[model samples]
Target: MTSRRSFIKATTLASAGLLIRPSALLPVSSRYIGLQLYTVRDAMQQNAAGTLQRVAGLGYNAVEGATYTGTQQFYGMNAKAFAALLKQQGLVMPSSHYRLGAEKMKGADVKGTMLHGWDKAVDDAATVGIQYMVCAFLSPQERGNPDHYKQLAADFNKAGETCKKAGIQFCYHNHDFEFQQQNGQYPYDILLHDTDAGLVKMEMDIYWVTRAGMDPVKLMNEHRGRFPLWHVKDMDSTPERKFTEVGSGTINFKNIFKHAQEAGLKYFFVEEDKCPGDPFASIAKSIGYIKKNLV
Candidate 1:
């Protein structure tokens, strides 16, 4: 049904795609997992490359997220520059978080200025060699109703399609809000039920999962390989919710990590909402415990 002009257009598109190398298509290694980096915000803020060297000294092989509040181009550095920095430090940025800002403030006009670039984000993530590009959090406006969920599912799928072209997957990280009840149905459930599992996946934060009074292992069992990422953190023992280093609290991480294979976990990152003392020290302790106990 296509005319010669249309066929030529399609051919050009295919040629453009073919121009990309295979390195753009796959990860160099599969076994190396990462950390989200926000977990040790303090250390990163203090010393960017130095912090990465310490993490490499630990068992961690990879890191996720990007920011350098005080250092050169920490938070707002271009993707190509940052990726080079990561490679220089002998770390892999397999994944990173991007705040999918609200719709009104997120049009194409807002890109590359107030917001990050749209197509350029994928291009940068691909340039940086990330296998996954994470839409890190949701806005309050997008968190209600089955219809809203349906729309979100559609958006995620669309985003995934874009990522597919770039040879990356898209993920949704969770807090407690998505689990809030609405219209006799939970929006999280609606997202799970409606979204294409292949296109849209999860990066569960175990601390928040437990804080929401849900069982991570049970959710893994119920989902059956849908979850491929996790944020490993522990809750404090007090009556009030607080972030604690790994193995310092009551979470049964051994049992959880045991379920890794069944959950099809591609990677995991350590994330702590807040640290009482030095966050880097806390991460070091957590990584030590994870190396000794969980891994």
Candidate 2:
């Protein structure tokens, strides 16, 4: 594990010449912390309402949703009912991950037919009062050819347009694969350069970017306001670099957060893909750490 002194020194060095002031990086308010519902998938799968009650009890005022499409419901409840449940728990969802189906993209024009059920998806999201709809993943077939990403970019722009019409923003969430080279060019770069910045935004998964040996702070500096949402998880200090509760691992979140303004970060959600014990317990620990240290 990195010592506190060493971590502070590293952060100071990293921020040099970046125009990021340490004083401005302090946690401004409690609303910054949020729970990604995927962290407690098992609990949610069994009892969505009860699980959300527990999430709110853990001091989470905001949440990001993961399940919406397959069940055509938000955790077995209709959109209105689900929204009511969230209200009862005193929580609000700002973003939800909606998969971009590969089947829908085939023989579909970017403007009209690329996304199936997207209009309904947007309607439900609006009913639930979400501000952003995220395209969560890309399947192997969709990413098999290098040229496919260009089409995907066009699809994203069209999707963003659709989302904009409905008073929502569209975003893409990335895994490590996006940073890898394909035909001597990074797919992530293609997406960034090809897509319209105003139309499409990005949700940065810090864990995946770190796993790919990339620096989140540098990426933020490079992009300068493209990322508005973040997945805030930590990596254990083992050879495997497994998922762990936030602030109990090797990732220097304090350092990354110092550049939050440049990253355009408005909200962040804690996500632990795997945990040693109860997911709720892990989230509690993460929240405690964030409150005391990272925020």
Give the winner by TM-score.
2
Predicted structure 1, TM vs. truth: 0.82
Give lDDT per model, in order: 0.70, 0.81
After superposition, the stretches of candidate 2 with alpha carbons farther than 4 Å from their true spots are 1-29, 103-114
RMSD of each: 6.9, 11.2
Model 1 gets an lDDT of 0.70
Per-residue alpha-carbon lDDT of candidate 1 for residues 116-230, written as tens digits (9 for 90 to 100): 3445566655656667677677777546577878987887787777676666778888898777787787777887888888888888888888888888989888897777778
Residue-level lDDT of model 2, residues 68-183, one tens digit each, is 76556888787778877887887888789987677443565232122766776776776677777898888776685568898899999998887777667899999999989988
For candidate 2, the C-alpha RMSD (Å) to the true structure equals 11.2
Clashes of 1: 3
